[model samples]
Target: MAIKVLVVDDEAAAIDVLKYYIDMTPTLSLLATFTDSRQAIQYCMLHDVDLLLCDIEMPLMNGLEVAEKQLGKTAVIFTTAHTNYAVKAFELNIVDYLVKPISYERFLQAISKYKEQFPTSVDDHFFVKTGTKGHLERINIADIIHVEGARNYVTIYHGTTQTITLLNLKDLEQRLPARDFLRIQKSSIVAIKHISGTKGGSVLLTNGNLVVIGPTYKEQVAKVINSKLIN
Candidate 1:
């Protein structure tokens, strides 16, 4: 399936460039374009947007406000001429930050990053390098319950066993299918299928282990829960 994309910018020219890029890329589909940030936010709230490309400096509502409003609903990539907001943008866990007059090459790179974080499909299994000799270990995605990040490495918990891999949590999060996994904390990513319930600020896995949801991620966890709640 093509990745659904939404472009938001006050400048007509910027929108045109983004549209052109989206058209040139076969993996992406343009869902909508917006010159007004508020209108864009409304559309996003009503649609299933996979990726969002927005400009930082706008007349009525800035891109930061839009991102804050639509947080956790979609992955965001900020495009602007200024470098002042780069730090803040990363803090929001934005996919990428592009300067104005974005080159086709750089734009493609950003899309690649998005693809890494939100894979198109989930595989039945994946391989991990193990031990000092770098032996390969095959792991079924279904067997994974949760992943805990410890500084430079992540411990992957499976059925009765755990595998420690020298990979950062954010990078590991990108490798897993977004639909099957949820990043509840800076150091934790859990398989959605294994999440039995949520208690207060923590997620209870089927294995009976509790993962504390970070304050920054609580809103996102709540949204996920609301979506799954049967009315």
Candidate 2:
């Protein structure tokens, strides 16, 4: 089932842009859109909205109040032009914050957070923003060989393809199943199933790759590897 989405923004142009983005995403179903914050709150009374993409500043009522009304019931992602509201928005424990005008790539990143909140199936896969704007690529957990991070990006190597996503390595590690993936270093994580063996201080992957174990993570990695050893 597609994630039921509701869009609320005072500006018609902003609503239209969100509508276009919602249409392009394969897994999202736009339930309705509202220009008035009050009307949006009313619409939620009669419908089941999985995700709410709402603006912070509105005419009659601001988006923060709108979120307060739907708290606990609907997962929210704030779309606003202001940078000051970030601290307060996260206090509500919403999915993500999108600073407008939000690009399609950034929209995808927000959707990725929504997906994390409500997983489709057994948490088997997740979407990542690809090189192209307005495009998202789904990556399966079981297919991943190893992931390495540099700067603000992480490269996911799976099957024969490598996809670079704008995400911190630590953030990505949190999403991956702990049992399925091993954090061998600060900069890289190897799929436990794809790990062939450890060669000296390095972890060897099935596809002929060696990831040097970070000193900070060595003890934890050693403990995991030692547990699997057949004495």
Candidate 3:
């Protein structure tokens, strides 16, 4: 069955781009598109939608407000030009926050994240093929410490060993459990349980590796740090 999707954006151009992308994706079916936030909310209330592609700075009712109203009714993927709302968006447990002028590749990555978070069957592990040899290795999700992306490959640090796979950071981020991992920078995703400290825009891992939090990711990273801090 196709995943039902509803798009809400104040800009006609943004909505058009999203609609075009939705049409191209075989797994997603467009239920409706609205320029008005209130109308979008009304439609969602009357229909069953699996995903909501929304914009944050819309007039009348912003995307955050809409997501708040929908709550458990639909999963939200924020499509906006601003990065400021990211902290609040993640607080709502939305699927993904996509910055504006979203590339087709990134849009697809968001869909992959949604599928991973709401899979039909529970998955505790995933496999990654070894470099060149084509041997598939099973990896327990809980054993991962962090993943670091370099050039075209990502190093998965798990247990006492690390495996370098030919996968980008965005793709790897979607595969990991969102609640257990977070993208602190463009090139790094850290396991929440392995974070030892956060200070001066850097995350200290249990292994003593410090990952610098990117400027755009500060708020989202701070939320994680704040939640874990003992007061």
Candidate 4:
């Protein structure tokens, strides 16, 4: 089934641009487009939607407010010109934040990341501790790598640099968003983001790290790879 999507923005031009991209993607279908924030909320409350693309500067209620109200029902992707809202948007657990004049490439990249992290239709986030120095790394649902288990702690590897932290894998797992991270084995949990290629009983990550896919995790690995859904 095509993903049910809603585009909300007071600007008619912005809505048209988003609609163009939505029409290009075969896996996605537009259910409704709203110029008013209140109307969008009403429709969302009444119906079920897979994804929501909303503008932050609406008159009645802002995108952040709408996202808080939606909770976990739909994947929220914010579109706006302001960069200051990046941090705040992260707090809302949004799927992706696109700046104004959003290009087709960037939009597609965001959706690609979204599908990779949310293969089973579950939307969520994850957290990792870098060290005991009162510092914690909170990652978006898509930006995680395999958690390597050490003797007394687990090291979280993400971004360009491999970050190792002083926290046990078990404790970290409990703190992380359950739906987004899946334990492939006792010692390792690979992020849906870093995964690049998969075959047999192993998976290749974007960082060039190859990890073994345990028997129990085979289904999850396959699902993650297939969810990319790109031709």
Candidate 5:
């Protein structure tokens, strides 16, 4: 599935360059471009946008305003000439924030986050081999409940079923990518898509699986929740 992207920047040159990089990536497709940040927010409300590339300072509205309005449907990556917005951008938990004048290399790095967020599933079901007869697994990315570490082994929980793989939790974490999967504890990483909400000591996944939150990972989890990725 091609990623539908919206570009919002006040500068014509910056928009052109950013669009160029987006076009270069075969997985991404440009949905629209807006010089006015206010119009960008309207576009977001009307359209199904997968990713957003927006500038911080604009005429009618700022990038953060645009991001706050659009964050529910689209993953944002801020493009700005100023360095001051970086901390705020991180606080927003944007996929990737780039300082202008942006290079194609840097642009590519940022867009890679989009790919990670919306990976193309091979089939409705796939296989993860662990050298013992190589079992066929019928897995959909959206159906994933929760993942937990049992010592050196990682357990994949989906629906009412569970599968244990020889891979460690960290190794599984690397494979899943941080853009969609967030580490809630050293032993657990919950899929952002699967998260319903957080309450008390529990992280509630959409599939109704409740995972415990670790004290060490509370700050990072707070950042994720406060950023409004999940309700």
Candidate 6:
């Protein structure tokens, strides 16, 4: 299903720009356009809108107020001329904030933020070519444990078997889902679910293997720990 979008801006130009962007994006579908915040809120409550591109300052209802009403029902991306509203708008757990006149590039950036927070399409499995002529193997994404890579080859470890492919770690890393995988070091990447524990500078996998975490990645590792474990 397409990600249903609703444009709620008092300005006709803003609404037109957003509508055009929504139409250009392959996954987005505009449900409706509203110059009135009240109507937008009412329609969203009665329907399903994946994202609400709303303006902050309006006659009856501001975007902040509109976001409050749509709290759990819909995700919001605020459009405003004032930078002052940025702090308050984020308090409502909105997807992104856009200051008009919103460039197409900036608009796409906000859409990317929405996509990352709410991933719509995730692959169940991916294919890799083997050394044999025209032989491709399907690797289940969930079964992945860890990956070890060298300059010329990448080795994937899943359950009890390992597969070596011609792709490097940098190339293979992009194929896996970011939410479920992490590049722990220069030469290795580990599946987040397969991590049993962490030592000083290493990750312990459930399969009884330890992978060293690179120095450059220690900050990201610390952040994950603070958000998911320590906090």
Best by lDDT: 2
Q: Model 5 reaches what TM-score against the true structure?
A: 0.52
Q: What does candidate 6's lDDT look like per residue over 1-231, in tens digits?
A: 357899998999888888877654445678899999999988987897899999998999888999999888898999888899988999999999999888766887898898889877766788888898899988898999999998889899988888888886655665676667777777888888898889888999999899998996787666555667852
TM-score against truth, every candidate = 0.53, 0.54, 0.56, 0.52, 0.52, 0.53
lDDT of each: 0.85, 0.86, 0.85, 0.77, 0.76, 0.83
Error of 3 at 8 (Å): 4.2
After superposing candidate 6 on the true structure, give the runs of residues whose Cα lies further than 4 Å from its correct spot.
122-231
Give the top-scoring candidate (TM-score). 3
lDDT of 1 by residue, 52-151 (tens): 9999999899999988987888899999998999999999999999998898769978998998898666457777878758688877878899999999
TM-score of 1: 0.53
The candidate, 3 or 6, that scores higher on lDDT is 3
Instruction: Give RMSD to native, each candidate.
Output: 14.3, 12.6, 10.3, 14.9, 13.3, 10.5
Error of 1 at 33 (Å): 0.5
lDDT of 2 by residue, 36-62 (tens): 999999999999889999999999989
**Lowest-sum lDDT 10-residue window in model 1:** 170-179
Superposed Cα deviation of residue 100, candidate 1 (Å): 1.4
For model 4 the local lDDT of residue 169 reads 63
TM-score of 2: 0.54
- Model 3 TM-score is 0.56
Provide the clash count, candidate 5: 0
Residues 155-184 of candidate 4: C-alpha lDDT, one tens digit per residue: 677666566766766556644444445566
Please tell me which model should have the higher lDDT, number 1 or number 5. 1
User: On a 0 to 100 scale, what is the lDDT of residue 167 in model 2?
Assistant: 88
